[model samples]
Target: MRLMLLIRLIFLLLLNGVVLSYAHAASLAYEFSRVSNNSTEDLGRQLSMLVTEQSGGALFTFSNRLGVPSSITDIYFDDASQPLFSSIAYHSDSGAGVSFDSQAAPANLPGGNVIGFLAGFSGDSSAQSVEGGVATKGVMKNGVNSTDEWVSFLGLWANAGSFDGLIKAFADAHFRVGLHVQAIGLAGRSDSYVNQPSPVPLPAAAWLFASALFGFIVIANRRKV
Candidate 1:
């Protein structure tokens, strides 16, 4: 009977460790690069928007200061190198100087709405063409490792011709670009964090708890004998 009780205690302790590990794994955290507002250097050729820490899931604002045509082309979530969503923006021949074709399908986001809006040239006028908009989604949580996540923006300027044209235009002076990004949510983590070499470290408390339980079991078994 004492042996059976010992086995049960060990099982319970192991289960508790697993639960704690899972809680740590799912504790959402995030990090992001500061938006480099470069419009001054490029004479409206560059600009930036921000998704600040205070706004949990609010839409930020963006602008195109360069007299030349420009628009946001893509948005990346979690991984800056890999865009989860994208869009197309261009000046219409006749109507609003700028229009957007958002590829934001909510299915891509884990939760919440993908919100967007237009302003300036896209909203009011196109003469100076000083208009743009921002969009965002999901309740960014706070944590690190599996918990960390973020969003990034990709904008383009004076792009014409085919998609190939845009690539070529990237090399030209008239073609400008900008970026705006922020890490929303909480939990502490470094921006450059990568997976640690595994055999995950066991928390010291787990070891202590297991040792205490084992001692208690030994005492109980002696008493039983």
Candidate 2:
């Protein structure tokens, strides 16, 4: 009976540890999609996307379907008017065909493009990555060109002090962004509906509680034995 009690106690401790680990670690995560399917003309030949609240952690990977030389110029978290982050050259990933001359074929941005400058949480610049998916055609009538680009940034973590208030502000809030032509003019405008931050599962804690109760029962039984 004593051995059983000890075994039960150990199991409960281990289970609680797992819950704590998950709660502590931040996984940079986010899901995104185009804002609308309106024709390119109706949308003004611009690129825009909505970043939903299905995002967590500090590392953010932002991708845009804008044409070449068109890049993410600003990021607005929640309702603030001024951009939370901005940069002219966010730097493209290898999949963006960094070497390819856009003027030659007027190719679209690579779907696997990644912007590295947005990473703020993880000090490791290399943590940003690009997943090169198939290049989808852009909102052009020609339908011959592909306009997509991506970049990863160590978001929030690195700039927490400057963005401390915004960590939770984005949850249930909208993220509006602007894409600009490298030369001049606005390329596109897009926004996403960010859901409220989902709470961590309580099942882990519930299991821990039950385990503790079981341990108590085991101890009580051993005393009687």
| lDDT (C-alpha, whole model) for all candidates | 0.29, 0.34
Q: Which residue runs of candidate 2 sit more than 4 Å off their true CA positions?
A: 1-25, 39-57, 63-150, 156-167, 174-225
Q: Pick the candidate with the highest TM-score.
A: 2
Give the TM-score (vs. native) of candidate 1: 0.22
lDDT of 1 by residue, 49-119 (tens): 32211111212233333332223322222212222113223322222233232333221221112211111
- The candidate scoring highest on lDDT is 2
Give the number of colliding residue pairs in candidate 1: 6
Error of 2 at 149 (Å): 8.7
Listed in order, each prediction's TM-score against the native is: 0.22, 0.32
Worst 10 contiguous positions by lDDT, candidate 1: 139-148
